[model samples]
Target chain A: MNAFIIADNIISPLGFTSSENFDELKKMHTGVKRLEKSTLSNEPVCAAVIDTNKLDAAFQKLSAKQEYTRLEKMVILSINDCLNQNKNIDISNKKTLFIFSSTKGNVDLLDASLASKFDKKRIYLWETANVIAKHFNNPNQALTVSNACISGVLAIILAKRLLEENKYDTIIVSGADILTHFVVSGFQSFKAISNEVAKPYDVKRDGISLGEGCGTVVVSNNKSLAVTLSASSRAESRDEGQASAIIISGGASSNDANHISGPSRTGDGLLLAIEKTLKESNVKASEVNYISGHGTATLYNDDMESLAITDAQLASVPMNSLKSYFGHTLGAAGVIESIIGIHSMRENTLIGTYNFNELGVTKPINIIKNTQKQEVNNCLKTAAGFGGCNAAVFFQKHR
Target chain B: MVNGTEVYSDSSLPSADFIKSAYKHFQLNYPKFYKMDHLCKLAMVASDLLLKHNPITKKYASEDIAIIIANSASSLEIDTEHQNTISDKNNYFPSPAVFVYTLANILIGEIAIRNSIKGENTFFIFDKFDADFMGSYNNSLLSSNKATCCISGWVEFYENEYEAFLYLVEKEKNELNIEHTSEQLNKLYINQI
Candidate 1:
């Protein structure tokens, strides 16, 4: 029951595809920048925003019309990129399921002026999925998943189940969120926004920098489930033919059951999720080599993650957070970060945890400070968000 | 089979009052209930009733139970409320309390904390009630040894209209008439039983 990720793309400020983003990461490039007198705040605020001019240019190349919203453009572009190279799969087939993951779809529509022109239905998440499906000429009904920060990972978990049931041969998952005044002011109100670039698990870390991006991944069952046996042993399966194939070993979601705005002091919820995922996947904490953490750089999140790692006995594993590079893309963080981790595993590389100067949490933990070349076989991705929700997923490199 | 309930508008009472009456019916004393948005309140009440009398869950570990919830209008009503707050540039006030429930999964958090159940849970937003998805998902979770029992169903709420149907799914049940299937779900859902 191997769910293989065949194709993927990440559209962000640094690049338009997963490979391009990975290249930027190898160079220690960051997209966060301070903006003065923007729509979100009166003073200067730092954020990672996709270049709108470049986005419009890309969207125009996709469609001649100038009607797509910023969010719409990003979604369509990311999904289209993956599907264009994916010739074996027919998105128009009813058996293929399309799932959209986003914390907020067209939330910019909430503005008074945008609200006037756009009907309330325009902001409905389901409608946004419909538009993306229609653009691709896919007849399958689209499903939207809105589970706060863990939406992206949950989508992967759900798609894996759907694949195991043989209901759909292929699942298309796209996750994205835009940085707007509505979101910025909300984070600002909670004092979760740092005036400068955030350093996750760093002594001087203050808050998270809001970011916007979209990511799409194509998932399907391993085509090589059937194979010939020689001496009661099989060399390889058809799906495992690709050297870079990545398989999802296990996924589990849990709730902090604590404060909605803050993470738990004990990190009990994330610990449960990690333990369950490992048990389900038959992987042990001692076997895990890399950790893709949900280090939002906020005081509570980093501290909580340290406690969870120690609780799960994974504190010493090489850990890195893409937040320092992408600045926390909300719903897209899990998918985008997971995609990078998958590629890193294939490339046999470990990325550096950016902006970290010293140990920030009370608990001792392992934070990768520089890029290292190593063979990574098994990696875990974990995220905890508002509403006391947490998700953990495991992945292994296909031989 | 363990529990089924629905809260909607009454000519004599508003939606909020109906939820209040349901809360009082169960004698729920949680102070946070009053602060939650409509969607969360409806879900919290439904789950409270489903698990209140089922003491069988005590036989398993705290993380043995899984929850799967979905709805069409995910925090749409609250989104509108939060929208109104920031709509006015002169009086822009975005409260973190309201912003927290913008996602539908927050209700899952409320129920998990109230009962001390730490298990796998997810929230889906579909255009319509897809019983097929719900049934198959929980089936996999249960069969794959992910959870010994599950609290799974659809919880949808808007400004004036609301409906909730949550069923307890487990391998061994203590005398319950309901079966975990799409057909049974439609039956209970249509009749609002």
Candidate 2:
């Protein structure tokens, strides 16, 4: 019952397709820069906003009848890229399952409809799923999962379970979140967004750079170069397990119940998640070769993650946060970071912690200062979000 | 390893009194349960019945237990409220406190913290009740040994309507007097006899 990720697609600050994004990563280039869009904040810093006109052209070519929001557009674009890579596959005959991961699912529609009252039927969950299903012509069952930051990873885990149970032959797990005034103002109100590009694991780090993007993966029972999704875990404990410690042989989601918008100073929940993930994965703290952290560059998140890794005895593991590269993409961070982790493992090289100049947090973890070539066999990808939710995913090279 | 308990808010009691009685039945302090939102209140009531005892004490570490709650509305009531506040141009900013509760799984987090039972937590959403999905998900967690004890069930809340049913599931060698099949669970909820 080994569920495998056969193909993946991403629309990020780097590029539109997986290969395109990979090309940029290989060149050590990033998609993060100053924010220029008018709909978003006048903040000078941002990352990876998709051009709506180009996205519209792509969507029109797919089908003229398909209407989508900024979030839905990302979903279709990423899913299209994945299906394109697997051209020989027939989606019609298979009982394909669509697992959408997002915190804001066309919530912008709710924002717009609020001005002029729209029917509840037009703005509910089923309607959101229908819009995507009709666009992709997917006749199979569709489900939307909203778990804050862990939404995307949870979708993948649920898809894996469905495939394992023989409920579906193909599970398309897609995650999308867009930059809307509603989302932007929410984070801004919390004082979580950074004025400069996010400096993950750095001493001078201020906060996170809010960004938008989407990532998708087609998972099945079929095995390939991609590693199998061994296990997905979540913390159900009240204290030590609050971080849903990454003690899974593969992955776990932990929460710091200490705050609604901030992390616990002790990083207790995060430490538990990492500990659980390592224990379940049967990989020791010392064996972990690298870490992809939820380096939102926010004063609290970076400091908290570093403390948690050190407490879990993973301080020496070379770690970096891609937020410095792509900013904080919220729900998409889990899958996007997992994809980056997979690529890093494949290349036997770890990406450096961008914008990291000094050690701000009092932790023992070694933040990779520059792109370093090393044999990375085992990697851990971790993310934390609003509601004190944190997730850590473990990846091993397919040997 | 077999136990069952049930608690309901008194229909005649005031809303505050009803919530207090539910908390008392679970042997939890009123303030502890009161700190939670309405969705959490529904889940806490169900979980108390399933566990038959308070598991949120400091004595028990949080990582030993897990919660898998399935729902339909998924914090919609709260979302609607938040949307309303931001709808007006003068008060465009949403309260971060209210915004955080918009996530459905926060109830799981609240329960875990209160009980000090930190294990794997997941929040699944289905359009309607699906016995097959629930059974399979429970079986998957048990078979994988990811959780030694699981608080699993459905808790749906919207407007003034609320319903929650939870069961404590764990692998056992001895057969219990109660029925274990999905059919049996469905019967329990529907019969109410």
Top lDDT prediction, candidate number: 1
Model 1 per-residue lDDT tens digits across residues A167-229: 788898998999888788778878898889889989999999989999888888854421111
DockQ of 1: 0.69
Please give the CA lDDT of all the candidate structures: 0.82, 0.68
Which CAPRI quality tier does the interface of model 1 achieve?
medium
lDDT of predicted model 2: 0.68
Best by TM-score: 1
Worst ten-residue run, lDDT, model 2 chain A? A239-248
Model 1: colliding residue pairs = none
Q: Residues B68-122, candidate 2, lDDT per residue (tens digit)?
A: 7777777776777777766676767677777767778887777665555656677
For candidate 1, state the interface root-mean-square deviation in angstroms to 1 decimal: 1.3
Residue-level lDDT tens digits of model 1 in B6-64 = 33334587777887887887787789899998888888887887777785457777788
**Total clashing pairs for each candidate:** 0, 44
